[model samples]
Structure formats: structure tokens, C-alpha cells
Target: MKPDTTAPLTFGMLVFDEVEVLDLGGPFEVFSTAGRLARTAADEPLLRVLTVAPTVRTVRARGGLTIVADHTLDEDPPFDVLVIPGGVTTAVERDEKVVDWLARRRRTSALTFSICTGAFLLAATGALDNRPATTHWEDQEELARRWPDVRLCTDVRWVDDGDIVTSAGISAGIDASLHVVARLFGEQLARRTARQMEYLWTDTRA
Candidate 1:
């Protein structure tokens, strides 16, 4: 199997059982299609996206859709960007292995992102300590109590706190990914990519 090597932008999206599909897939589409979107009378898609899961077998998402993992965490390469997807299971409050991986990768990645409840995983790594952040609205209360060091915002779609980024809910993940593309490439490119994905890109967070 060959990778979609059109844009040269490499992404690693962490997948596990019950991952919120859109949180991961949204960015994958935005980033992977960037090369095609950026194709300005000359360029095609230069982006390469790999779906990394805990296991190589197809893992079911929260919605019962089975997805084939392109790479396992063990085979994960050094991604230019790392995306952390959220699910209701993420709210269970403890998943040590994932927490550990985020802790390790956040230090090396160019960007670390979280969607909805996935911010809990980032917070577990102490990356957001004393930093401004926003997670799913429902978790704002407990998140504040559990991690008092983090300034949790209940009103934003996402928060870009330097090296780390956090999004509010499921669809907010879409907004976060577009913002990432804009920062890396340009607003024009991001808008182009969003249009291709049929995303409206209405982020009021900034």
C-alpha cells in the first residue's frame, strides 16, 4: 500500500477503541487534502497522513464504525504533528498508557492537539499546567477541580497555548485543524482546504 504522498506534510493521528472518528478524521481530511487544495495551477497534494492506533487491527469508533489502522503506535514515526482525538470513554478519568504517550510525544512534536474530552489526556501530561485551555463544556467543572493549575475556558471552541492546542467539542475539532493549517501554511490555504472538505470554518475562538 502506498501513502498519499502529495503534500509532504506528515501527520500522526492517535486512534484507539472508541475514538471519536471526526476528531481524528477531520484533521486527516484537512491536512491530507491540503496538497490538493494548495495545488495552485502547479502543485497537487503533498500531504501524507497515517492513522496510528494501539493495534494494527480495525478498531471500532464510538459510533460502531470499524476503522483499519494504518500504523500502530509502536511503528509511529516522528510526526510533524500529533492529533489526539476524544471520545466519551475519555471521560472515564484514567488511561495510563495514553497519558504516558502524550507526555512523551508532546515534548518532540511541532504541535500537539486535542479535541473535546481529549484535553484530559493532554492535561494528564502536565503540559497545560498554569496554561490557558478549554475542553468540553461539561468537563470544565471537574477539569478545574482536578487540575487547578489549568485555566479552563468554557466558552471557546479551542485554545492554542503555544506548543499545545485544545478544542472544545466534537465539531470544534474541525475548527482546530483548520486553524492549524492556517498557521502552518496560510489562511488562504486553510480556507481552500476547508472548502474542499465542506467545512464552514466558523471559529469564534480567536
Candidate 2:
């Protein structure tokens, strides 16, 4: 489905048990704050940010951070941008239902991206097949071993392959989110938002 570019981009970050807190929280901060900072004269935000979980409840994240999902998988609104964050993801990676949902999203969402080991879950849907992608440096070999069809790379902050983007672990998600903002809005707006977060945005690719 072709997206209406004029509409506010709705970003949904998928969260599961043991998800990396920084992976989800970092991008959430970037997109939500950037949307506020990038509002127009109409006062409509440029982006809408929310969390999606298998269920509508709090999930324990890595480092014991508890996060309540804004929407459940079946009740979420249409997502223009879907973010998959990574941590201890064996459960999500092996879930057939979740993989099917991701496959469907890949066909419809304007953009579908992943951070760190979340690439494993995305890869299970075959979305990353024969496409360049990156994950956390530590899991680079294992990801390649499991998803041989995917062109996995390392030493990169993120890989922006048009509709799909994958980034390195944790903090790298922030850079990738800013990159998305820059692509959709403008560099000036992304820079300003990064400044507000006191984060130095890096666009370097490997």
C-alpha cells in the first residue's frame, strides 16, 4: 500500500520480554521528541510514537526496566514505521506468529527497521534475505550463520536499505532514528532534535 506522505508518520516499537531498554527507549525519545520539535504551523506533530507488545501489559526489559506497551499486537493502529528492538530474543525469534506479522508489515509499512539482535526476528520473516543488514557487533557471526541469505555486515552504525533499516546495538538505534527523521523531514530538523537530546548523531556506515 502506498503511504500518504502528508500524514503524520506513526512509529511503533515492538517490545517483548528481555528487550533491551536502551534499544526501545532511545528511539522512542528521538522520534517522539523530534516530532514535537518538528511540528508545523498547524501544530500537528510530524510523528506519532508508541510501543507494541504481544499483550497490553508491562514487560520486564533487560536491566530489569519495566515498560508498559501502549498497544497490543492485535489492537495497534496502522504503523508507518515499525521498529524491532533486540536483546534476549530467542522467544521472539522463534515465534511463527510474530514472524508472520512481520512479513505482513514488510509488505505494507513504509519502513520496517530493527536494532541489534532484533535483526534475527526480522530475518526470520525473510525480509532481510539477500539484503544488506547489520546488528550488534558481538552477534554478527551468529546472525550470518543463521541467516545465510542475508548480506550481514559489521563495523557499521546502521544499514539504510531504503524501506528496511538495521542498526547496531543499543545507542546505535538513536542514530538510525535520527537518520529516519532526516530522511523524512530534513537534516536541520534532525540536528536540532539531536542537540535537544545532547546526542551527537553519527551517519557513518560500514
Give the TM-scores of the predictions, in the order they appear: 0.86, 0.94
Per-residue alpha-carbon lDDT of candidate 1 for residues 1-206, written as tens digits (9 for 90 to 100): 12233435567777778888777777777788786665432365455577777646578888898889887766756777778888865533366766677688888887788887777777888988999988788878978998899988878888988778899888888888888877777788788888888878975684
Once fitted onto the true fold, the runs of candidate 2 whose alpha carbons sit more than 4 angstroms away are 1-6
- Model 2, 1-206: lDDT tens digits are 33244567788789999999898888889999988887655567878788878765689999998888887778856878888999999988777777888788778888898999989999999899999999999999999999999998888999999999999999999898888888877888889999999998886664
lDDT on C-alpha atoms for all candidate structures: 0.76, 0.86
Best by TM-score: 2
Model 1 residue runs over 4 Å out of place are 1-7, 39-44, 90-93
The C-alpha local distance difference test score for the whole of candidate 2 amounts to: 0.86
